[model samples]
Target: MKASVTDKLKILADAAKYDVSCASSGSKRNNKNKGLGNATGMGICHSYTEDGRCVSLLKILLTNHCIYDCAYCVSRKSNDIKRVAFTVEEVVDLTINFYRRNYIEGLFLSSGIFKNADYTNERLIRIAKKLRNEHNFNGYIHLKIIPGASPEVMREAGVYADRLSVNLEIPSERSLQKIAPEKDHKSVYTPMNWLKEQIAENREDSRKFRKTPMFAPGGQSTQMVVGATPETDHHILNLSASLYKEQLLKRVYYSGYIPISEDERLPALKQAPLIRENRLYQADWLYRFYGFEVNEIIDETQPNLDLEIDPKLGYALRHLDQFPVDVNRAPYEMILRVPGIGVKTAQLIVKSRKYGRVRYEDIKKMGAAMNRAKYFIEISGRPLPAASAVPERIRHEIIYPAKKAQLTLF
Candidate 1:
């Protein structure tokens, strides 16, 4: 007997959990009242199927048969996992039905590489094209741009997708070969470059056409698998930094590599390290928005981030001679690098300090993280946590590694 639509949704959504880009909060677009579009910043919540995972969209694979036997993927051909594919109409019906019932915001459609990259991407694009042009359904569509897919297909996919992504899958090409061997690094990055170009071109067109059509209004993003290989935190952040700088990516998601594929080449971790992924993200943030370079954030001297200390504090300690920034007198750039002060707090400090000298107590009012900030800031006539009187022993107690050797200059 054939399973019902809910049965397929259960299997597919469980499979889709491996993808990290499904968090539906980053971009916002709305649904038309009578039509099938709705993106309220929050994607649909109550469409829970058999799995306890939140139902954001009708997430599913276009096909499960793959050409690549990536050693780290459950969908690898060598793995004996159950396989399934939704016919284009079946997917269309499932999405339309799910939307009508208010189950999903849009479709996050991906696939295991079947036949070829172009063939796989074509099927994925067909779903988006049908959703937009044929059905006029315009919720959030996040389509995967299968690496090695032709530029023309990428252009078509971009036209319909709210966002497009090509998973980097592994941190280094060396690891990629060790695991996802059939996958090409050029294939992955080339399409990323293509989508970025298309988005830029589309943005330019919209600027001139005013009422011109929108192409991927949400922008492009990619994923990097963490701990799957011997790649360090520094290595991961460096790759992300390069992606952000050159590819003009919106976000780079980090997934802790789960040993879903039972390849002997893969690590047998007790559990995936979410903390490692989190630290990479923090480092990536510092690189992108915080105006820190990859070299400054992590380097040959310290090839990996201190697992215990936040990167901001780590930087401050390494560059200790620059510390004790005067809250009332320091420049904004100097204030921002303080261990406990974020960009927001730094802005607030500068803004309020202009009128009158800000006090230590007032610093916390602006949302500075007092515990770490207190060690580095002095405000008004009152010093923070009495920085002026803080003995060297106290500062040493807080910093990392407890090295008895003398601290060297940067």
Candidate 2:
């Protein structure tokens, strides 16, 4: 039986919730010629998760009728589920109408492979074109570039999409083969490389000529499914570091694998590995912004992250010899390694110290978490906690202060 658009919307929208890379930042497409919407660099906001991720986009799959029977995927061909797809015009109408009502700030379109790579990719491109040309939508549009598609079709896709992404899915190629036999790493990397070249070339041309069109102005990003396979956190972080360095990817999202159906190849998790996924993101942040290396976060000895403590706190606890840092004299980089001091707070401390000696009160007012920072930092005339200052004691105190206090009373 044929399903109505509302029925298709319910199924497709629910399916799209698994993708966590729909953040609408880093793109600034201003509306011209009195267009409908615009994507500002600040961000688009309609809904948010508990973690504060933006969910303003009309994120949905173009179709769920995939040819491949990936063991991890819900929409795989072998699954007993209703199948439906939207016509090209139907998608355009939804975007236009939804934007007018302020229900969505943009569109995030991905699809399960329908027939072949090119055939599926072309339909995605047509929908984006009609929105831009016919309806004049200048808002953000992020497209999932289909792997194994021709370079010509992908290049045209880059011209219209504000951002492009290709999900690596599994951390290792061997794991990918075991799970999704029909896909490979090469098929994914091929389109990514082409987009990188195009985006770079377009930038050069735009600088030389004022009217050069932007190509994926928000740049390219990729996502990896965590906990689906046996890859450790160390392996995952190393792969992510390489992608940021080699491919020049803007973001690498970590999606905790959700068990759809029981497959021998998959793990038997009661729920998604949400906590581990969050820890990886924190570790990734330390690598990208906090000037830490992958080895510093977790090495071959301790492959997985400490499920209880964050990666930053874990580092601080491991290297207690480097603590008792004097914020007044320490360099900005050293201050950043502190457990409670964030990037902003560290910068403020550096700037404020140059004017005068930054006391304990000053740092507290600057928003440094005194509960954690007080133990690690040495402020003038303010002594650190003399009791339980060792690594084991500090870890226990920070993680369980109430228990530590009860013992101290004895």
Candidate 3:
């Protein structure tokens, strides 16, 4: 007997859990002329489920019948899982009905290759197109770009998709070859480069003419799976930095490798590397927003992150010479380098400085993480934490405050 739509949804939804690149920020599609929904500039008001999947969007896979037998994938051709696919109209109905019930604010659709790249990509596009033209659904729609799909098809995709992504599952090409032999990095980069140019061109056209259609205003993003290969955090972060600078990507998602099979080629992990995944994100944030270089967070000397503490704290410990920054007198750039001061806290400190010299008590009021920052920041009249203190002692006090060795660093 053929599977019902509910059965297909259960299987495909489970398969889509591996993808963590579905965020609704940076899109501004409004519900004009009796449209069903809207995607705002402030982003969709969404929250995560207990397992970390973005529940605000109806995240699902159109199908899990893949042509490639990648070693790490759950839906690979060699897997003996029950497979099913949703028809284009069935997907449209689901989106429309689900929206009516307020179960989702938008749609995040991905699919495994069926027959070939173009065939699968076209089906994905058709779902988006129908949602826009037939049902007048104007909510956010994020579509995954099938690697090696023609530019012509991708152009149409940009028209309907608020954001597009291509998952670069492995950080290095050599690792990609060993794990997913049938795939190549070129297939992924080609589509990403093309989207970059087209989004740029579309912006220029829109500037010249107001009636020009939108082409992925939210921009492109990609994912790189961690712990699946031997590539260190250095290699992973360097690849991410290059993507942000060169490709002009909106985001680089880091998904921990979830061991799906006992294949000899893959690691036998009892759980996903969630901690390492979080550390990479923290490191990524430091590079993007905190004015730190990739090498500063992790370098040739220490390739992997210190899983015990965050990247910012690790940096402060490594370079003790820069610590105990004077909050009242230090430059805003230097203030950001302090481990306990966040971007917002740094800004607050700077803004308060214009009125008067920022004090230790005022910083506490701003919610600065003084436990860690106390050792790293110096306020006027308030004596500096003992700069002569050993780095190991500071690290121990920060990591384990209960053991509170009478620290030389206040």
Candidate 4:
């Protein structure tokens, strides 16, 4: 029996929830000359703005049928799930209709490998091509590149899509082999490398030729599943560091592993490691924006992130000797290492201190979370009291400050 479009949407959209790499940032496609839509602004998904307004996206899978039996995947061939695939026209129609109604700001399309990588990738490319050439969709489009797909197909995909991603589901090559024997790091990295080259060539061409077409203008990103195997946070962050340095990846998403099946090979988790997942994101932010190295966040001795507090605070607590950083005198790098000071705050401190000393009140106005920053930064060369520098005491105060009052009353 043929399913209605709504039914297919329900199935496919639900199937896509596990994929957390759908944040639409960095694309600047404007709707010029009366095109249907524009992506000149920040790409929207289920992400929020600083003002706390939520923007939505038409995030869904092209299909939920797979040929590989990856133990961690819900749509694995061995899993008994309802199977459905959207025709090219169906996806195009849905995207156009949804956009016209303002139901979504963009489209994020991924798929389970139906027959083979090439076949599935071709279908994805066709969807983007039809939307751009035939329908004149000037809106944002993020396509998930199929692993092991040909470079030719990938090149074509780049010509239409604003962003492309390939999920490296598992972190380590050995663990990936154990769960998904059909996939390897090469199959994932090869297409990523090809996309990197294509984006670079496109940029170079646009420099020389005024009207060169953009190839994945939003840049490429990838994801890795956390807690599925015995790999440590150190391993995951190291891989992310390498990707950022070598592949020049735009984002590396860490999705906490969700147990979809009762496979003996997979972990028997009662719930997803949401705290760890959030910590990984915080650590990733430190790496990207705060100028932190992977070793600074985690080491061989501390293999995992401290889930109670964020990575920056954890680092400050670990190395008490580094604080309290004098906001008016410290280098930008050292100011960034302070517990409560973010990149923006650190920048404000550096900019404002050029005139005179930056007081605590001034720092607070600059957006420093002073509750945490007060303990890690100095005011007019006055450091935090020596007693507050103890790592264990600081940890206790930061994690359970309310308890301190209760203990004092007792």
Pairs with steric clashes in candidate 3: 324-376
331-350: candidate 3 lDDT, tens digit per residue: 99999998778989999999
Q: How many pairs of residues collide in each model? A: 2, 0, 1, 0
| Candidate 2 lDDT by residue in tens digits, 1-410 | 78889998999987787888877788889998998898997666787867677778889899999998878888888889988888887788898889899887788999989889889998999899889988889988999887888898888888889999988989999999999999999999998888888888988999999999889999999999999999999999999999898888999999999988787789898998989999999999999999998899999999999998889989988888788788998899999999999999999999988899998789999999887888789877445764234778777778898887899799
lDDT of each: 0.79, 0.88, 0.88, 0.87
User: After superposition, which runs of candidate 1 have C-alpha atoms over 4 Å from their true positions?
Assistant: 23-34, 38-57, 93-104, 381-410
Q: Estimate each model's TM-score.
A: 0.86, 0.96, 0.95, 0.95
lDDT of 4 by residue, 269-337 (tens): 999898999999999999998888889899989999998999999988888888888888889999999
Off by over 4 Å in 2: 49-53, 381-383, 386-389
Give the Å shift of residue 236 in candidate 4.
0.4
Task: In model 2, state the lDDT of residue 15.
Answer: 75
Off-target runs (Cα >4 Å) in candidate 3 are 381-383, 386-388, 405-410
Q: Candidates sorted by TM-score, descending order?
A: 2, 3, 4, 1
- Judge candidate 3 against the unseen true structure and give its global Cα lDDT, from 0 to 1: 0.88
Please give the distance, in angstroms, between residue 403's alpha carbon in candidate 3 and its true position after superposition: 1.9
Worst 10 residues of 2 by lDDT: 380-389
